[model samples]
Target: MMIGELFDPQAPLAISEHYRPHWSQAGAIVFITFRTADSIPYEVLQRWEREKNEWIARNTGRNADWRKVLPELDPRLRHQFKKTFNRLREDFLDTCNGKCVLRQPDFASIVADSLSHFDGKRYRLGDFIVMPNHVHLLASFPSEETMIGQCDSWLHYTAWKINQQLGNKGKFWQQEPFDHLVRSPEQYQYLCNYIRDNGTKANLRSGDFLYRQHDNHQ
Candidate 1:
């Protein structure tokens, strides 16, 4: 199927819901963010969890329409559901919670290697940055198989290797990652900027952050 058709808004999407709903579309450009296990503060996470539950309560069931649901929701609730997520993410990431293991040069290199290991093999990687507590990436998956399998592989392998290096067997990352489909050129550029500026925004030192993008070299 054509990438555009695969991501048609009207087309039925295979969504996996845990704390947040994950939309999977074959052959789509995606922006993904995943964080270390303790990246979010406990109080912030508790509030986020409560808000997510409330959102699910408002937008549950198979027949619910996203387009209409937002319009119908209370203005304040809609703002939380639609608007504040970015702020929330930025706030949490800025907190720099957890061990900040990626601050270590070796650990950060492992993550960078893991992210680049499948470039051009599983997906066409555009831009990515490894932050101290979290990572952001923009890439295009060539197929459903590549999207599902390779994403899991990257995360699993990185967590395992990082854990081995840290000598801790506990969870290395948060289970759920944030993913958004990039459907337009404008949105694509926005994500590129987001990834590029993440380190600066988070006040990361040069050695603590690794950023690579196709546009910069070319």
Candidate 2:
């Protein structure tokens, strides 16, 4: 039932960049979202990426290093950018794109089990849901490395198992997941509510998605 601590702005933060930048704070609760590789259409993703790059260039100047530009933005502007970026993608996810194999109870169960495997030992598991084509969860890791490593472990294991079940090959998950450190109690509760309500918002029927929340919180 440990929700962990909120992020401290003064504390040292870790920034990891791949296709996008990920910010991590040791011991702070984080909300994460990862989707199937085919969840978003290629054209749609390409367009989104183009628009994002354009926005970055307009705001931070042409060819500005995203790694530095993002972290250096005004807090309000950064929040605005992130909110819009996430919202557009989330709206598309709600359309239930891709094969949505996870809609099957058996496939979804594999992911739920993988996420719970190391619960308290490696990181504190919080509210999580296995959606049709994506997953959303909250957890706190002992260190920034643990957070990144655990996310990879979960993605790798679940993808392998699920792919084996389907006799399919190749990538199962999108390489980079979207993650954010919990900034305050309000934001933590907001994420909890978001997880709880995602299925309904996506119009997924009962048994089409798997949702779990701590009993203490409910």
Candidate lDDT scores, in order, read 0.73, 0.88
Expressed as tens digits, the lDDT of each residue in 1-218 for candidate 1 is 11232246765456665432167666677778888888987888778766665565665642454545656766776766755666777767966788888888788889888878867667777788888888888767755556666667777899999888778897888877888777676677777788888887888778878888765323
Per TM-score, the best of the predicted structures is 2
N/CA/C clash count, model 2: 0
For residues 72-133, what per-residue lDDT tens digits would candidate 2 score against the true structure?
Answer: 88888788778888899999998999999999999999999999999889999999999999
Q: Candidate 1 overall Cα lDDT vs. reference?
A: 0.73
Model 2: which ten-residue window has the lowest total lDDT? 15-24
Alpha carbon lDDT at 200, candidate 2: 97
Error of 2 at 136 (Å): 0.2
